[model samples]
Target chain A: MSDSTPSTPRGSADPFVPAELYTQVQQFYARQMGLLDDGFPDAWADTFTEDAVFQEASRLDEPLRGRDAIRDSSRARKKRLEAEEIDFRHWLGMLDVRPQADGSLHARSYALAMRTRRGGELDIFASVVCHDRLVSVEGAWQVAERDLHHDGSGRD
Target chain B: MSDSTPSTPRGSADPFVPAELYTQVQQFYARQMGLLDDGFPDAWADTFTEDAVFQEASRLDEPLRGRDAIRDSSRARKKRLEAEEIDFRHWLGMLDVRPQADGSLHARSYALAMRTRRGGELDIFASVVCHDRLVSVEGAWQVAERDLHHDGSGRD
Candidate 1:
């Protein structure tokens, strides 16, 4: 909330972005993941651009192209988890943010999917490295591409 | 490493600190926790002020006082974990940063300790919310006090 305006000049392309931009990117992920965990699949998908591509290299044969495709997959996953009485919290950390030459941002982070079953135990559902291409749309950050690399899958 | 310089004027503590200060606080925790996880207990302890106090409300009857005490405890724990061939990775997220009237920073974050046994399984060792009072010492951030609230303990 501390002034999300782009303070850096266009085409700066710094190895690391400004601290304000870094904090903003973290907040953006927090909101996006919170939306997904709260069962708002459409809202979560809306954080992505219309033609965003999401790929899990370890499992997916091809990327899920487009926001609609992402939304459908998220909804189906949420429904299955709900039926199984499982709750998931996606935690992100160790973020690396850098400015791109085209006024976009490159973000990479470690993603942990912590799963808990109602009246049951808590466990790790997935551990992956997320690489994202972020662009601004209407002054809000949106994911244009996301590639996930699962741990120990030799995908990297 | 965007300038760690305090840009905000003194005695102007808002509900939240500036975004640059927020990101710097995150970086501080990243380095502090990384040192502990990387088997540098003494180095990790050095991140705290000499008179720092650390307390776990749910478990510790009395808080650990002084950097020496913290270092001793951390070294002992590290030895035990190494003997058992266990590796831990501390992941922190959802950080809340606010400025204090005393020019210090109040930072709170969700900390996840993920444990992995050599050639064995990976699991969550602990989940806690860490509340810290961070002070700048010689232009470097250090923990002055830390209070940990473990999940399901209801100490909060």
Candidate 2:
């Protein structure tokens, strides 16, 4: 998400979207693609708050917390897919955003990600939904938080 | 990635990080974990700009554009995953945000995801990156655009 400063009511009326802001968001997400796809553990660490309460818990598993811990997890996961250097391609569509009373906003986006390995017959895909928060920082808009949703539920 | 606004500064006087901005970022990323684990897509759409761009590209590839198109991509992906009623879990972590000129931001994050099938060693883990933009909408922050990086290039 584009991380930037908040505008006063006196600014753009009707809560219209600005091209500049969209550009910023594009850039931010682009960088994230780099960190995740490039297998850069340290890069992911720069995405959240220092004391961020990062936990990815499943319905049947415990949660993973903290930036450093998350980095380790990312490294491990990347290593597994590193064989033949499989590439994960995400196709996100169907998004809707709404404003909140507390000046916070919420958004839901639908995504389809495909992972294709080099010279392989496997090209796996998954469906996902994303939830996130945006907060103004240092005069820019940035992703204050983010979460991912995998569609449909059934036991393994 | 969160595309909503939380209160923070444009730049921090401190060398690396600032206190308020740090906490806001933490809250933002943590907020996402809760939303996705719960699988709430309806609320997720409200986080974006009305005229937003959603893309899926390599950090090095040309970006796909627009919210409506992104939606189509999402639907296609969801159908594919829901097959056989598998339960998928998205592991989101390793967030990094960088301030930019024009009051925007670029960020990097990592995800380790898996699915539980009817019977098997579950599914493969996923590694993904995202690009997002932020803008001031109605005096608050909201996502202007979002891009998906799945090529595993990490070329930001």
Best by DockQ: 1
lDDT of 1 at B83: 78
Give per-candidate clash totals: 0, 64
Task: Show model 1 residue runs off by greater than 4 Å.
Answer: A1-19, B1-18, B28-88, B93-111, B115-120, B126-156
Q: What DockQ do you compute for every candidate structure?
A: 0.14, 0.05
Model 1 CA lDDT for position B54: 97
- Which digits, one per residue and each the tens of the lDDT, describe model 1 over residues A81-100? 99999899998887867677
The ten-residue window of minimal lDDT in model 1 chain A covers A1-10
**CAPRI quality band, candidate 1:** incorrect
Please give the C-alpha DockQ score of model 1.
Answer: 0.14
Model 2: which docking level applies?
A: incorrect
DockQ score of the complex predicted as candidate 2: 0.05
TM-score of each: 0.58, 0.42
What ranges in model 2 sit over 4 Å off? A1-16, A53-60, A99-105, A139-142, A154-156, B1-156
RMSD for all candidates, in order, please: 10.7, 15.6
**lDDT for each of the candidates?**
0.80, 0.51
